[model samples]
Target chain A: MTSGITRRVRVLLWAARAGAADHSAVFTWKTWLFGWFVRMLAQVLFFATAGNLLGPGQARYLLVGNAVLMVALHGLFATASTTWELENGTLPLLVASPSSPSLVLTGRSLFWLPDGVACGLGAFLLLGPVVHLPIGLSAVALVTCLLVLVGLTTYALGLFLGSLVLTATDLRNVVSNAALVVMMALSGVEVPASAVGPVLGRIGAALPLTHGLLAIRRVLDGRGGGQVALLAAQEALVGACWLAAAVAVLTLRARRSRRDGAALFLT
Target chain B: MSLLAAAGRFQGQLVLTHRDYLIDLVRTPLLAAVFLLLVRHSGQPQLIAYGLVAPVLMAVWSMAMLISGEVVDSDRQLGTLELVIAAPVDFARLVVSRVWVTTTISLLTVVEVFAVSVLGFGITPEVDHPVVLVLGLLATAAATAGAAGLMAALFVATRTARTFQNTLSYPFLLLGGVFVPLDRLPAWTHPLGRLIYLSWSADLLRAALAPAPVAGAAWRICVILGLGLLAALVGRLVLGRVVRMVRETGTVGLR
Candidate 1:
């Protein structure tokens, strides 16, 4: 049992490293930096311009919201990389392996944590001069924690969605695109939750990014540390629940696939 | 069938059979709805109009761009690019036909957004000059197709064509003034924006939708059409050169 656990851990670590390398291999360091910087800047400018038209004192709101959203977006893309396995016809092997499929999925997403944090921090820092928000080091640190939680939650949610690709492989683009737009609309990414109507506001409350954004806003506005900590705790709890849900869903799906021999015929 | 007719029919068939292509049709309106949701709280009729129109323009541009942007690469991926190239047909005309069909399909997004804006949100944008608005949409479609052809020519031989295609979207949206007026951008970018046909198209669109007519409508329309012609000429030259290069190097389906 001890060796089995060790072997699983070793496999998980190997998969995480391989995933990270594959993700990074899509672009050179220079290309990645330039592409992401330009993309994030464009996104920030687009929303900030819209905020300008909306009303006064709203640019900052949009800047922070979109910056944090970059993290969740990264998480979504990271989890969606699982589709590559299906495309390459390796998904069934992963499912049929002695190691747990849930663990493998989690490992596949581990690298996104750092990638999300970097995007969040990079967006904040890059847009800081443009938007001119009053962010200090301590506040930055606090937002970093908030972004980490958001990343975990979004990654878990992405994993759940990615696992659904096992049955509907062609849904990869539709699901990711729809989820990004839906999350952006509902999670106060570019709009305040209160203004998004009661129904959407309730939905937003269930999303992990909403609480994290709320907490980051408070910290940026110089709120007390106690409230920030409470919000962070809530965000973490939401993320934990999503991770647990993803595990349950993946387990159930794996069992179904095995029982029906669907794993053998996955295209 | 003629190459143009065949290409158009092929593209239409692809759109019909490919679930992904059908899903692509829905992305724009969903994004438009998201934009609408973001600005719904503003309660300002003008802001609502701007939000609604921006997404429609983006949908038009994206669809036109993707038709050419993905055409060659997709053919290559499916191992049919060499066959298409080997056919004794005007390749540039084939590309143009494909883009034209895509542009026509993309126009549905404008109607979809209009319906959503009016029926879903109770915001009916005013079009003071319906004729000018229609003309503007036509010009925008032609210019976007030209630009897509130009990009398709440039991307056909490149390994990172898809990446470049995706990266061009936001920058074009910014420079095209899809979401904001040209004057709102940095002063230096104004000239750059004016160079893009989408900027002119957006100006014409905003003017048509505004309660009063804005000046320079005629000139903007002329410039947009002229740019479309220029892009078409340049794209034809580039596509011819790239095809020759690919034939010489025998890299039609490579990568």
Candidate 2:
């Protein structure tokens, strides 16, 4: 009998394979270049506008905020793309494979790490024209850690939403879209949460974006990675909650589908 | 030759289409409510702050149209394209009618936003220039219709247009002066904003309603309307040719 570690590795390998398959259709180098070109152009344009509008230091802060925001968007929305697959009747096949659903989703999201990191660096590079911030390896480490937490939480949310497709009638896409748009608006990425009112401020304070942004803000202001501990803890707690929720919902949906003989909808 | 008969036919179609659009728009009040709450939360809870909601709401409207376009695409894929094309009506007229219906629905959605602002946020439109306001709204409606049509055509052509639509639509949301002032855009994006119908429409509305009178608000409205009409024409031409080709060739098994 294989040990648990070996078995887990096998599952991870299979999950990676599944993730690779999802993008096989659109994974051309041209597509990657197109995506990068568009994103980089937009980022440059955004930075130029911000630099002209704000003081140099403030522009640097805004860029840091946008960097953290890019991580949040790439991580969270990448997971949601998996939910779209599930809702479209392609997720069941992946889940039925040797790989677990969570592993599969993780692998799929991790595939975007290269793109996210590249674009983030591109955005950070533009920051030099705006301000002279003390960005070092420690700031990088903090952003990376915060990104991990964001990815984990977002993956869990995606799984929970995907599981609902088993019995949902029509509102899945609407719910997903609404959730994403609301998250983007409330994340305090573009605008300060404090400017938005008490209710929105409270909501923003509870979000991972707020914590990650605060961490980056401090780092850009000369504080090192030490400030990330509080944010990491909150993100860990939120990730745990969402992960547990995803497991419960996925199991319930899978069990129901099996009982109803509707497992065909999974793939 | 009777005017009543012609008017009856067109009016009947218009009313029915408007009713369908209304039903769809009203089905999701929660999102609209969230937008209202977002504006209130943005710490700019004055009646003039209603302008802040324009960008996001317009984006939402675009998404709604995209979703509906996907539905239409699915129908086309299922061999229903020919049925619509074969109907005893001009293709351009049909497309325009559908867009008109959708634009009316978006207008109603804005009305709902205003109502929510008045009730929930305690804001009121100054209504200094009623003519400008009405014209501005109509211009905005026209612009939205054009954008929707363009997206519909794009989606109809490519199966994977959703992601492109999603990523590309935000420019209008951000650069169109809906949430922020247009002057805030960097020099580069400022000119591009002119290319976007939303920017022109938003500028017209803002000029009409904001405390100060904007120079050439009427001209901006005309330019926006012209762009909108041009977009609508292009959309019709592209979608019609594609649909006709699909019908003749049965390409990709679509009717």
Candidate 3:
């Protein structure tokens, strides 16, 4: 007798709790900060300094670009995490239930969102000045908002990919890692969209991280918040489309599997 | 040695058909793309050698040693560590054989990255000294296999082994001049590069690509061999100590 949206929200909230409980053992705060966070920062450093090898000016461009890439990584987390229900032998139960599985899937990896945002922001704040990136008060606030939007959009893309390959759960992580690697190459992360040429530029335009990275860079450029807002809105829109596609795929896959009453995705 | 060779060949055959393993190799080209494309965009085509060569060498480290380190971690997770520890075969030798398979397999990345550069980027990176290049590849494979011992020891030794392994991956790649050269890194980090065999191997391999005569190739190759031997010795000692402790504590069952 609860409203439909309300019930789904509750499922998401509870699923996020499960996810938090599950991953808490993987990395305590100390380990997460000193260990995982440091690793992400080092990755940013690796790319940024590599940029410096080309020319001094190229460093900050790469620093900002790779920093935002840390956000997209959370999206990849969503891919593997959504496949968890399939992993833990709960796919059949969740499919059998009247509740929507996509909601639960979304919530399961919600923990990665904050971690992604932290890595993105930490890369910016900690290493920004090393390359002489001007960090004013307004810049920080804008970049934070941009990071959140980018995280949500990329997470949506991840869910869609996860749903598409629910049965082949073993390849979920591979898909996520490969997709990220491809994105890092093709996305306007290290190179401008225009520079990748027309075909690749169009492909980059369609990816979640491309627009999000642009928004972050625009925010840093301080040309004004208007363009950044427009870019953020585009990122959010892309995310929404991915979210809708994810829901449709999840629903169709679940119903079809239930009808077949075979291949329960135990593996 | 024959047993090791046979074991390595068997694992290589199995991993060759493995979806996960093949996909791991597939990353080499994409990684190459990421590095080379950045150089292209930077308006410095001469620097392309670093981009072209780095991923191939990085594939050596990540594919051979990084994946090699995971052997123990995965065995532990699969509850096979106890069997491995108790097997009649020597544990270190078993691990060395597994690393042997991956090191040989890692060579395919050389072809993969080179093809990607020529076909994908239209840049042909030439090797001026094939003899030194071939010798460098052999020495690198040996050194990489040797380091796997250390990597495995770390995995068996600590609870934070995975994190440690993850942390070491890119830094090693960085030290190896994946996207940046060794000289470009901070002067203070120079000695640290000396500690990693990939650093010397990168210099040797890149020098082979240059048309100029490669000086001190023998010394560099010897240094790589020495470092590799040292790592293997240290790895065996640490692995023995850790296995003893794990057996004494009976905590192989625990993380």
Candidate 4:
């Protein structure tokens, strides 16, 4: 971390190392495959049924909804899985080995990138024929926006959740579920905010998910450039806030743990 | 008279179950309220219904899985599985007694959710077929129980029971006709869902609730019954194997 490499360079290195550590630590490919298959199948079934009810025109809507679900769930997964590592006493070694915690966390998030992409585009392609998504540059923009906004939002939230384990015990389900339910609900992943009413409508309006999802939808319609930049900017802002929150929590926990003799749990 | 006494004794084991149920109800009332409110306009808005049901199903499913995991892990932690196995209490009765407690909580949660939805959301399905609606609700609960039982067994048997609880059920919630209808799935994924108990539960619920007439009611019942039976059998078989494995090689932490 201190070999005079720039901070951005160090962060990338940490991210890659974190990804490697996670893959190596949790070497349950069989279980991963099983869980992945189950989720993919369930997602496919959901969209197929939704398409049946709304017709082809609404297929893109359902596809985007599913994409948001993937992002939200992945965020929870990455966050919880990382915290579980910390709680069980494996994260400290990586943290102390010249890599910043932030970089390592980012690296661990890379594993989900492929799956996230697949889930986002796979749902679209699988349901596109049924829904008649207009093929063009906008589709690319739609996928890109989803990858960045939804993806970044999830990563930041995951880090935030991971930070909670620093001072708390037995609050995993409560914290994880609350963060996920709010994110999913506010993001309008399950239903567009338009139908949920005024109070929730306002709340959703303030969140990044609504904008991120809307941006993706616009991209799907083949609109790009300035609009995409604006949407990305909104997502980046939300992501930055969440990222800051996660970092704050992690730093606080690290300081407290060191003072409390709980540093033994680190590495 | 002896049989009655025995049944009474069995019921007595479930005394703690009510407190458990009440505590959970208190904790999750907000979530339940929010869900029902969202679904008030489900009839006219398909997306709203999708949003409402996905989280509702997840909340309920998580409750069931968490309770079941608690049952299994506590037994494992306390090394009481062997004690319970050695006891002369009827094994079936033991399972039921424990399940009765969790199942009761789950049912009460469902009822509370429905009642709140009705009172708050003003959602009134045509009582033109109250019997069918009740039956549909019953089948849904049964299916949930079956899935819960199977999950319990799976977790009890596996080293990674905790992870399995989340990883396994996450998929079911997504495809259980909560967010999207079953018909939307590709033909290839249909067989996969049919293998999961949630598919059957969704089918039973949709048949009962969706503004469609019930056809082949007898067949639907059979399908529900078949799933419930299959789940019970599988759970038992898996538990047996897991117990054997645990006995032969001491259980260790999941990797």
Worst 10-residue lDDT window for candidate 4 chain A reads A165-174
lDDT of 2 by residue, A1-267 (tens): 578778867776765565566555544565555654355445444533443343334355456656555555554444445555555576667546654555555455455445555555556655544555455777666656666566556555555565564334244455445554455456655556665578977876655556656665665566664556776667677667766776676666555555677664432
Error of 4 at B132 (Å): 4.1
| Each prediction's whole-model lDDT (CA) | 0.77, 0.57, 0.81, 0.58
Q: Pick the DockQ winner.
A: 3
Best by lDDT: 3
Please state the Cα-based DockQ of model 4 relative to the true two-chain complex.
Answer: 0.26
> What is the descending lDDT order?
3, 1, 4, 2
- CA lDDT, candidate 2, residue B98: 57
TM-score of each: 0.94, 0.78, 0.94, 0.74
Q: Write the per-residue lDDT of candidate 4 for residues B1-255, one digit (tens) a residue.
A: 454355345433533432332334443445554444334423444333343344445555666676654555556565766766555664434554465456555556555556655675666434334566567556655655666667767776665766655465556665555555556666776776666555655555555555667777666666766776687677767766765565467552221
Per-residue lDDT of model 2, residues B64-107, tens digit only: 46543443464465575566667666654555555555556456
In terms of lDDT, the poorest run of 10 residues in model 2 chain A is: A47-56
Q: List ranges where model 4 is wrong by over 4 Å.
A: A1-19, A24-34, A54-56, A90-115, A134-138, A197-199, A256-267, B1-74, B77-79, B82-93, B115-128, B154-167, B170-219, B241-255
What proportion of the real contacts between chains A and B does each prediction keep? 0.49, 0.03, 0.56, 0.18
Off by over 4 Å in 3: B244-255
For residue A220, what is the lDDT in candidate 3?
Answer: 79
Which TM-score value belongs to model 3? 0.94
Q: Tell me the alpha-carbon RMSD of every candidate.
A: 2.1, 5.4, 2.2, 5.7
